[model samples]
Target: MPSDGFRGLVYGDWHFLEETTSKSKDSHVSSNYAYSMGIALRGAHYKVYPELKYDSVKPMLFQKHAAMSINLRNTQPMMLQNVQMKAVITKQGVFSQKRIFSVNNSKIAPNSIVTLPVQWQFDELKPGKYKVQVQVKGENDWNKLPMTWKFIKNIKVDKKAADNINDKIMRKPINKWFYISMATGGLMLISLVELLKLLLTGSK
Candidate 1:
């Protein structure tokens, strides 16, 4: 006969329980083993963090062009595939016409970080507060499931400043044209003087 401790337990094809109590049926026991295992498996497939770096330290002032840096760091043990990065801009609270930019079907190796450069032209945007969102999506090594992440930032636009910048940019070509015209006129005058001197010398 088996011991009293093992009396209620069956030996064949039986499952093991850490401990048993009189009230075991009424009590609840939770284990994180499944959760940890899931995380471990997913970690081998797809895991990453997204970060955004603006061009300037100060709050962004509205201009003809705005730029930022995007970074993705893979925390997984295996390489990730079909990685896509997309940026969206909203004016006040409304979505812009379309996505600002996107990098599709990229690949990232395990524990590696990637940087993407992005630029937005806001000449048509009015002075106000705008929201910029960056999203990253990718497939795991197994390609069974997809993962997604996002980062957000707020930007302030100043029309006066933007106009000043635009004006300066516009004036540059005009200034160059003016300088070229002046040089051409000077050269023509020199040529005219030389031609007149040659003509007079020939007549003499």
Candidate 2:
């Protein structure tokens, strides 16, 4: 969460390759925002989270908020009356709800910073590669600025620590005998305490 009001919403996940580019290139070229592109070299799995929510229990499970932002200026910027943003998470191109933002630039300067929200949830998601696409609809055309990313399984959220312990118990019978022995010892210890209390109280 950014106090200044910039966050990276989970736009889903996408697979993409990485390459270096020069700073002098144009925005439309693959090298223009080369820094924003390329993240799919690790393997075929990555998790994408739209704007991340702060959770104390599983802080690392969610994606970090977007520190990177865009600065726009309207030089007769077509009165960008409507600004719609959306996030897509798959290669098949399934999209989330379109968040339409209304901005009246006529009253304010063109350099004002605006925050965009991106969040998503999947009913049943397995470990795999996902494409994250951020689309912004402006005055004339739709800015389908695509970025590739990865999605990995969140083991902590998906599996509980107690469940892991139970699994360990089930894996081998040796732990079961140990547990029985410990329980027996605990009972004997309790009985010994009671006997000592009685003896101290003169058989009361």
Candidate 3:
């Protein structure tokens, strides 16, 4: 039996050889015994996949905040416990940011699927291409077997367009007020000019 509570192979054999000179001696025989024990094996398999969503029309364009959904499935027959989830964001293969989330001492039954959602903000990120990677690790209560999963996604950032959208949302009312003020000032100036012309003609 292995440390993972699995048994692989157990073998035993016995062999005996008879002596030729039985008349000279009372009886003589040779015997041999063999035994082999194999190491114990651990069994736990997991399937991990990632899904990404953005507010922009283009899936590749990541603006504002992006939602990362991670799907985990237990493909083995054993239950997995103490699952830990981690996510990392990179810019052109360079390290950018990372986040860690855990499932405590929970157990995921066999053939069961779980979805985890993570939010990433791009407000502070500069305009460029980025890579998002998600990782999941699980261990049994006995701590004998460990399972892991990793996934990656590519995205492009348009800081200029994001800034424009933000500016429009923030200053929409202010722009409307400015336009109204300009139209009113123009009308008042035109009326003053007409009054001044009438006064000049009267004086002449």
lDDT of each: 0.54, 0.32, 0.51
TM-score versus the correct structure, for each prediction? 0.38, 0.20, 0.34
Clashes of 1: 0
> Candidate 1 regions off by >4 Å?
1-66, 91-99, 121-130, 155-204
Ranked by TM-score, the better of candidates 1 and 3 is 1
Q: How high a TM-score does candidate 2 get?
A: 0.20
lDDT of 2 by residue, 103-203 (tens): 33222112233333332222222222333344444332123233222222212223343233233232223568889999999999999999999899995
User: How much lDDT does candidate 3 score?
Assistant: 0.51
Report the alpha-carbon TM-score of model 3 versus the true structure: 0.34
Best by TM-score: 1
Give the clashing residue pairs of candidate 3, or none: 2-40
